[model samples]
Target chain A: MASVYIPTPLRKFTNNTAKVEIQASNVDEVLSNLVSQFPDMKKHLYTSDGKIPSFINIFVDDEDIRNLQEGATDLSDRSVVSIVPAIAGGVDFSKEELARYNRHIIIPEFGMEAQRKLKASKVLVIGSGGLGSPMLLYLAAAGIGTIGIVDFDVVDDSNLQRQVLYGVKEVGTPKVESAKKRLTELNPHITIKTYNEMFTSANALDIVKEYDIVADGTDNFQTRYLVNDACVLLGKPNVYASIFQFEGQVSVFNYLDENGERGPNYRDLYAYPPPPGLVPSCAEGGVLGVLPGIIGSIQALEVIKVASGVGDVLSGRFFTFDALTFQTRTLNFRKNPNNPISGEKPTITGLIDYEEFCGLKAEKQVKEITADELHQWMIEGRDFQLIDVREPYEYDIVNIGAELIPLSDLPYETDKISKDKKVVVHCKMGGRSKKGIMELEAKFGFDNLYNLKGGVIEYVSNYDPEASIY
Target chain B: MPVSNVSPDCKEVRFEIASRDFLVAERLAEKDNLELTGIYHTHLIDSAYPSETDRMSAFPNFSYLIISLPNLRFSEMRFWRLNSNNQFEEEVFEILN
Candidate 1:
């Protein structure tokens, strides 16, 4: 009896036995036996023409049968024939597809061998939204061998204006599922693995381990910092692209530079999260429809360059495009003296909590109130002390009738605020309030504090129509 | 049949090893001139195993040093002396940890 190991996705066909033992000799016989035993397995494993589906790869023992006579590769009694459906995530390309990219193939810099490297490489794209759409498309078209898409979001109707991967029909489907279907149709030869889960700290390392490079198309600061940390920790090259309104920046960081030295990662560039409300997301700031597309395609080019080992990768250098002026500037950023990785030969071998490091995660609760809830509190005439911890200028501009103390002067102002009364601290966004809460609790020994989740911006948008928050 | 690829004089002088690596076993064999018999570069990447590119480029029948760069510094150094079947089996080294 030959043991056939079915992957998790194909378990439904095998009656949920991840491992199914069947009577056979040789690889062909083993598969045929499985098909004969479970006819449903055949449909998933093969096409109507009797060829193995491009999505699945057959391995006899630990060796890839493709290198060992493929499906006809021999199998012995008790041999393990593992049927692994190539995870459909990003982009897949083949050597034969080199002709399709002949213009790139002929460039003395990037030849067939370079293209072959691109075809054999695995890349993980971090988003499936505006930036991710074009990034995935170009990478697929260029024929990256294995592409993984890590996105937990589903397609939204509002996303259609910018996200190119999802169509009108895929409006309500999971982003990864729609991306997988569309990308496979775009380049039938590539293997794509879709993870419909968030790239959290727990799974970030494992998910990132399989790929040589990561393309970050994410928008939020939490995801950006998380991706940077994971890539640096895994020693994987990260091609980073960010879009805000009409401005776009693209760079490759945490990769081995020309001198075999790793350059500054995002942490080195921005030590901590920008004072929460200082940066507005694309959702709030509103991005130009084509901004991400332009930046993302360049990100794809950088990924291809990194994977193929051709041309100078954009490590330590950033290229910015101003859509308003139609001008591009390449800013050569050197490694900062204060960078943790500078002067020391450092390697990130494990995943760390980037959200915690950036103070974005809710590790400690400060005086917090949701915008809607805070509005409700206002309407009810609550007697709690609403201390606005944002800057004085911010308070001078417009505030919800709270006393302005500012985060920096909180130490001196802590003496005035009575510990007997509940101090409900608030910042423009929730991040500063979290820090402020920790400070007040640690110093003044204040037992009562709260952080306004989503902060004043959410407050004004949801409640006050005349107030300007940004 | 494979013959020796190291020379005698090369064995007397200590070969250049990075400060992060450890000294294991050394031999004197010959291909033409005095060539050091068993020497391999430390593994800069993880996985504690040789890469496909490594197999295609380096010595196949000699003792190789496998060092892991764990702390961004060289972590473990294991010596592997190849057997007659061209398979690398780890050889014990007496170096202090």
Candidate 2:
């Protein structure tokens, strides 16, 4: 006798019995017997053509009958049968989008279903700079239903080197405006929303709530942290990429997988931001022209994978590419136990001023002497300990006869300086020198230390133009 | 037979018998000195087939009977049983007048 398990929706036909046993040799006989006992159920199970409906799936002995000989599959005396209906997620695609995404629709893994999911998704891209240029272009081309661009800067002539979204004609135009015009022209099927304002903590949540995923292409720690925190709070996946002179990094953060487990977030990779001005911005450090294109395209790929539900995403993993060495590496990372978002309760509830959070804001009041004032002091033969906190190579390039004490060795070489003499410190610019004065004042308790405002670069430009600029 | 109550865990598109209801049914079957051979429920709109949630929460070693009520009125019913791997299979039954 073959046994069958009835689902909740079909129990009414069997006198409220959940199961029954009957004599049957195959799936066809079992279904035939089912219809014989409850004739009305036949209409619901089969189409007018007498064929089984696509939504109705029959399993024989835990295996889908479709994988077997289907209705003709022979069943043993002890075989069990189950009638299961396919579950459908509500995603629809118009004929136009289907035609537009025909290439994606034809792929086996990413067919019409995945293309529908892509058209149902919304993605937010932060910045219209180097990385955002390519990221937004590809996402739009791939038929992301809605794309939000956050940028406040106008297209500059220097940005044309890597920000490929704009040309010489767009030099003075705002980036979001130019990006919207270009992306709309690329795919008029998608909706492009531009935020012509800075992505700040005050509006991060409001903007992020409307998007399904966020792609961080901004070039600063403040905006990066703000975006990350907002996404983490809103439970959105953050596709992150950053480009430096010759290297780039890409990762997906705060993504919740199918199993209801969250992957590592940005904070897990970088526990905290680097000290302000410690890592120079792209403007200060420089970047290869084509690096953002490569990294940002990868970011777009990850976003598409996430939206379409095709291919494995880069969740909990970090990828690095060095264009100079032509090397690539992928490293796996786990959620940090100490990370605020890891434990049962997260610590970060709302956004804060990221500039102050990353220590970019000046906290202490320090005395400063400008280049002209320092020049006057030098000419008047001022008795003071002039210390140069810039690197030896930079000092070699040009110097104002100040004593050389690189910032890295300042702590160890503190004994060489006289605590009684008035001290002035300088770096390439005023940033590092200000740091040096702060360290001297806090660590060594040097009360007379003063920061040489505008450092050697400013001094040379103002005091002596003949000095070669490094 | 009438459905006494809908499962508290029932969603708009999915349904499940509450654990407490299952316990009560088991207790009643035990008190009546009857072997708990099968369970049954009703569907108001969908076809007479198990949903994914039903498969996930199905009990092994028992028959499952489902009643389909297309318009809040009894229409049809069928019986099923679970196999060794927990997948359901339909079983034949008859009512003798």
Candidate 3:
């Protein structure tokens, strides 16, 4: 009989005993001896492919049996074998977990080592809903070492469609607790840390720093921006995946490689925040139940790839999936010159009030109309004077029946223009119009000057498509 | 590294420098002989100067080409020919229609 020392986590596999004696010779024989006696321990120890589960490290005396002889390691009489789960309360495959992860262990490209890394990794999942549900479950099942979840919401009946982490019994319980219970049951070998509160800017940096990578499964913009800024400030890798009804976007941001070359952050792609209310949340628009499964799976893949240091990590690139057309598009975003991130570090030190930054909180200003409305006004012979504040080349292309007074030449044209008349200023795409408005208001002191929204792009839409005035 | 040989394909012969790039250039140069010359890489957002990292890391035995990306445009290309003294002399290469 060979005596095996079972660690704290794996002691449950050995009837909560620190040591168990089983009759066997080789490592395979030893496992078979234990399995025959316990019957229930087979699924806990061996993967579906008949190899040892990755999270459990077996050592003979002093040598890790994985590097020594694997499952084929021979055992002598009175030989000391240790079965220790790599993490404390970390992700461990129970017999059921081993069965569920059989397919992964069998794949040679991933095999045992990848699973071991998963078990040793500490991944903090930001939300326990939709995308977070699958992401957490898969990471747990994969045998990740420590899984920390930050969520304050309670499990709602509506969350059952996609949040596989919680179920009917967990309806009113807090999401973090419910998820913790389920994950612990799924694999008692994993350490499940739960924070029953929303992630805020004050705690974001500290919380994110503890884990190697943060999976942002958040649902709103405020949290998303806060998390992004915090990740950038703390220099943690943010594995970002967002879903909107039928579509999803995934990208990796803010982590340096071993060589000290900093990878791209979120601001490298999106320089500005999305206009509020323009982008609807998954709650309002509704997502296909299976969509999060696809996206969350990919997010898990990115986490594994990043943790393992094997595959090409998606940094500064967005992989977008469109369920409507069944097409996947990859948009490569290069580092923007005006990117709030400077030289591999974030330029925006702290999170700004994004609602204010996005003009969501700004009071409505003077009225504005579409190009079609302007055209209709012209057809009705309105008395307002139209002014073009575009560059010479832009004005040379197209102008909506306006007097050409380039922004640079605005001071020269100011004397000839009447401040009493209501002046409508426009440019190619409205950028120059804002500049013109500033110049006119601040420098020229023209109180009546108004900037056109969406500029000439709106104006050209009203013209006949067949006619070519050019 | 600077350009050792010059070949003209209406004023642009891809500049080749590094060992890997030289092998590629040599093979392409053999096939396209007279039309190909040296290769060039643009250093964008850096000074009109070469950095210490660039100078120390680069092979000094061969000539090198450095084009600042800040100055690069569709109409004009600025060429810096490095001398034996490690000093760069400017040569303007203009694209003619």
Best lDDT among the predictions, by candidate number: 2
Candidate 2 - CAPRI tier? Answer: incorrect
Segments in model 2 whose C-alpha atoms lie over 4 Å from true places: A1-91, A341-346, A364-470, B1-97
For candidate 2, give fnat to 2 decimals. Answer: 0.00
**Model 3 Cα lDDT, one tens digit per residue, B1-97:** 2333221211121222222233334335446642223334554323234333334323222223455443354322445544557655555565598
What does candidate 3 score on TM?
A: 0.47
Q: iRMS of every model, one decimal?
A: 20.6, 11.8, 28.0
Query: Candidate 1 chain A — worst ten consecutive residues by lDDT sum?
Result: A86-95
Q: Pick by DockQ: which candidate is best?
A: 2
lDDT of 1 by residue, A1-470 (tens): 78887654456677766578888767778777888888977867778998887656677776777789887777678587877543211012222453477676557577545766887899999988999999999998888989999999989999988898888999888999999999899888789999999988899889999999999999888888778878877788889999999999999989886578887777677756876667999999999989988898889989988898887888878899999999999987776555443325444345566666556665554445677777777789876778888998887777888888888898887776767766677888778878888988897788878778877777777777799767
By TM-score, the best candidate is: 2
* TM-scores, each model vs. reference: 0.50, 0.51, 0.47
- Regions of candidate 1 where Cα sits further than 4 Å from its true position: A1-103, A340-352, A359-470, B1-97
lDDT of each: 0.73, 0.81, 0.70
Distance from true location, Cα of A284 in model 2, Å: 1.4
- Give one digit per residue, the lDDT tens place, for model 1 in B45-89: 233444333332233334566565633587677776545454657
Using DockQ as the measure, name the better of candidate 1 and candidate 2. Answer: 2
DockQ for each model: 0.02, 0.03, 0.01
- DockQ (C-alpha) of model 2? 0.03
Measured with C-alpha atoms, the lDDT of residue A65 in candidate 3 is 72
User: After aligning candidate 2 to the native by TM-score, how far in Å is the CA of A138 from where it should be?
Assistant: 0.6
Per-residue accuracy of model 3 over A1-470 as CA lDDT, tens digit each: 78876544344456766568878887778777888877867766888988887645677766777678787888889788766442211112334544566676557577545665676688889988988999988888777789899999999999999988888999999999999988888877779899998797667777888898888998887777777777877777889999988999999887677787667767677667788888888988899988998899899888878876667888867999999999999888766567674544446777676656666676435445567767777789877888888777766666666888887888777875678777787877677777767766777677887777788776675564542233
